[model samples]
Target: MQKLIRRREANPGVDWAEGGLHPLLARVYTGRGVAAPDELELGLGHLVLPDKLLHADRAAILLADALAADKHILIVGDYDADGATSTALAVSVLRDFGCRHVSYLVPNRFEYGYGLTPEIVELAITNGSPDIIVTVDNGISSIEGVAAARDAGIRTLITDHHLAGTTLPDAEVIVNPNQPGCEFPSKNLAGVGVIFYIMLALRAELRRRDWFAGRKEPNLSQYADLVALGTVADVVPLDRNNRILVAAGLQRIRKSQARPGIMALLEVASRSPHNVVASDLGFAVGPRINAAGRLDDISVGIECLLQHDHAAARALAAELHQKNQDRRLIEADMQQQALQLLDQITVETESAPVAMTLYQPDWHQGVIGILASRIKDRLHRPTIAFADGDAGEIKGSARSIPGIHIRDILDAVATRHPGMILKFGGHAMAAGLSIPRDAYAAFHDAFVAEVELHAEEVMLQAVIESDGELAPDDFNLELASALRFAGPWGQHFPEPVFDGVFDIINQRLVGEKHLKLVLSHPDSAQLLDVIAFNIDPQEWPNQTLSRVHLAYRLDVNEFRGRRSVQLVAEHLSAAE
Candidate 1:
């Protein structure tokens, strides 16, 4: 799968430099659609007011009432990083507000599956006969689960960020920006972000009721660390609102004011809290937390976040780190098997299917999502990886290329084929579903047809967007450091990448799969240090190549207390 590089179109009309942005950073931000200076402001005051989120006030009132009446409040959470953070955030904040009998239950992915299912509801009842059930990061589609709780004489408040279905859950109050007719400006809130907003509203409600006269008011901004981790971990778009949350969170972590769990996770990942960034959270800490949910129960992660003792948090972090290591081994094996399966199918560019679906009966259910994502990126097509489920069922995790709404495609398949898919729900780029084990072939064909019906030719082609090229002057440490921190970038707001032709002064292999190189521009004699990670072992360190075109990021590499500019190559190819 060869890729095409396309530079983003810059907005020339916006005077980014006039807004006090560095020339290089100004150009990068302009390419990402930053039209005004205020958009760059990431202070807590710039966050969208909680009043705009539909039913946030009502939900706050509900939770406040529960607290006022000393009712048992139980949080139903999903089994992912966002869910863990949301559950922890809700529990910590409510308890900080002096609410007694606050507990939570996260459904294990293996036994109870996702969301608040009826089985999970029964489990929750047996676990902690609660008076009010607060669902964080889930329950938007748990129609049956909410009904069960309602029939059990329990009140339910649903706070989720996933796309709502045709019929909303019958919970007592729902707080989601994507819900019908919601006026909240940003709809890209992760599950954790939704719960964060609800907590803020709850604080306000409590404040208005004079409930904080004798109690210390929890500064919700302090919890931004959790919000930041969840927002980046869930891979939500970094819209201005989300950027504010992430920026605030990064500020706290950088000052070492983050919670014990975050600090402990960072320590395990070898990231310094004094200079932590959004990517550090997304790549290093987030994965360790998510590994708990993937390989075991998510309670390990939630407990780590809620723990006030540093030693206990570190112990949980170590466990999560081990789980992550195990997940990597399992994922590597599954990916190899998937690659072997792909080799058996069409290999030609033109003849290959627009969508790919692979299944192995022995594949670990916890890792199918990652396998699907890897295949989707490798082949630049919508991909789904399936693993054996209960008795006669097979569970699939789907990852889609751009321009294809995977969840909608699943919906179409379910709408047309009726019983082929048992249940499905997700956002545009990813989804999950289940079907009879015997119906694998039929479901695969139906899925391919639906994808082909919706996919465009260009959509199937892998393309990398670049921020154009950098000049010799731009290859300095100041600009690199500025660009690095200029963004809490993720998803929609991408980090800056540039492409240019460079002379390969020297090349060598480092750390087995990475390539280290010294390169210089044709016009400039100054050589630049470059490194590309996870390169193809069979094709790298080509001694015959004199010049190459490289897509890379200007990064500052620090070694032995020394920092210098280094280009991190994302893609490289021979140049004419």
Candidate 2:
């Protein structure tokens, strides 16, 4: 493990004391271009009203027309946490807005594949005969599918947060903040956030038209919990706009007034919504939602979110809980298999490049991305994992390291060997693709060549960023709460990492492979339990009283009736 501490300089334009922010926080905010106290405002008043978002009014008009005409409306959602939440939000909001003939469909990873494909559109037609289709979390990449929907005389509204392709789809309304030429400041809004914004706009439009004269004007903010869950799960950068969304959702969650499904899911996870934090959403709630998509159809997750009856919601939540556990088991097995294959290949001796491509006929297509991520973390290389699918096609997922763009590599491969790849799209760090099984070898060669051209730019070392050292006094519960409530933390705005040198006072294995340690500084000792998951004890330092440096995040762990702040170590190494 490599320790890299980058000291951030403060900006003179901001007053840290007035904002009630720590010095380190001020430095990080300044580095992230946050200038003044006003920039940190997180009140609902600061959120971008739905009317301000692009195409929101148009989407509302389209939905209103569909509702008046009693035309069937089908929602097409992606198969992920964000997509599941977006689908639920859309269904819940649309039903509240008097849309009666509405249903949702999520593409299966093993069957119809990802996004709004032609097959999915055909399935929607067969299932609902939808006169209009609304796509959540996906559709910006579905040029052909959009055309197909148009051919079927179905109006389409795309609500997505993914980067747009070169050619925009021919949808009636495109509400993506990341779309080209959109001046939305918070381009990092999740797909669910985008849909929620659309709902806000729709409600406003209804109010303007006096459409709420007899019925109640739905408070769209009530769905903020769903927005927060999706935004955190999607791993988008939590910008100012997203922070407000998550903060609002956290407020609702803390009140325990969230939807029955959300409440039930929290209960199933043994987490109290009244005390829910961002970490709970990311690790606990998000994974359960994503499990439905990864291991089975995501409709189960959407149902869990949209079901109104408490008993039904509880049952669904329990089902999703079991699915998430099954997903973990599958992921662990696949990761081990991938590692075994990687061990056979001498990455250092390979002259072509350090890029990795693995294929297993028995691998589950839904979990390939997780397996790819695991391999990439261990090897520190751009990795792609493929599984055989129906009709001789191979579905693959790619994960990239810091300096390598997996999507760009895929694009290069497609450009060099046109028609070799069936389809592919994603951001810099992650991507998905499908190819004919016979073309895998050629695609693999081209991908490796592309990665080799950029290999020097990719740093394979695990560099840990930290805020130096601090005393045990700084580990108060109040400080932990302050860190938790400071602002939304995610991909770009990372949670604070801390580092310190300590003596290993005690060590033992807990829960099979996890190592628990009691560490001590020069002045004080703390009972720190470190869980190096799946790590062998023999690989750790053997000296009984060795000095070691640790990079970790501070977390408040609650067990039984006790609450204590603990350091969750990311990396540990013997001191030089």
**Number of the top-ranking candidate, with lDDT as the measure:** 1
Q: Clash totals for all models, in order?
A: 0, 0
The all-Cα superposition gives candidate 2 an RMSD in Å to the true structure of 2.3
Instruction: Give each model a TM-score.
Output: 0.99, 0.94
- Tell me how far the alpha carbon of residue 289 in candidate 2 is from the true structure, in angstroms, after superposition: 1.4
1-576 per-residue lDDT for model 1 (tens digits): 567899999888886656777877878888999988778988899889999999999999998998899999999998889999999999999999999899999988888889988898898889878999999888989999999999888889999998989999998999999999899999999999999999999999998999999878989998999999999999999999999999999999999999999999999999989878889989999999989998988999999999999999999999999999999999999999998998888555566798989999999998999999998888888999999988899999999988999999999999999999998999899899999999999999999999989988998878889999888888888898888888988999998999999999999999999999999998899999999998887889998899999999999998999999999998899886
Show where candidate 2 strays beyond 4 Å.
1-13, 22-33, 348-352, 525-531
RMSD of each: 1.1, 2.3
Highest TM-score among the candidates is held by which one?
A: 1
lDDT of 2 by residue, 247-314 (tens): 88989988877888889888989987877877788989988988998888899999989988999999
Q: Give each model's whole-structure lDDT.
A: 0.92, 0.82
Worst 10 residues of 2 by lDDT: 1-10
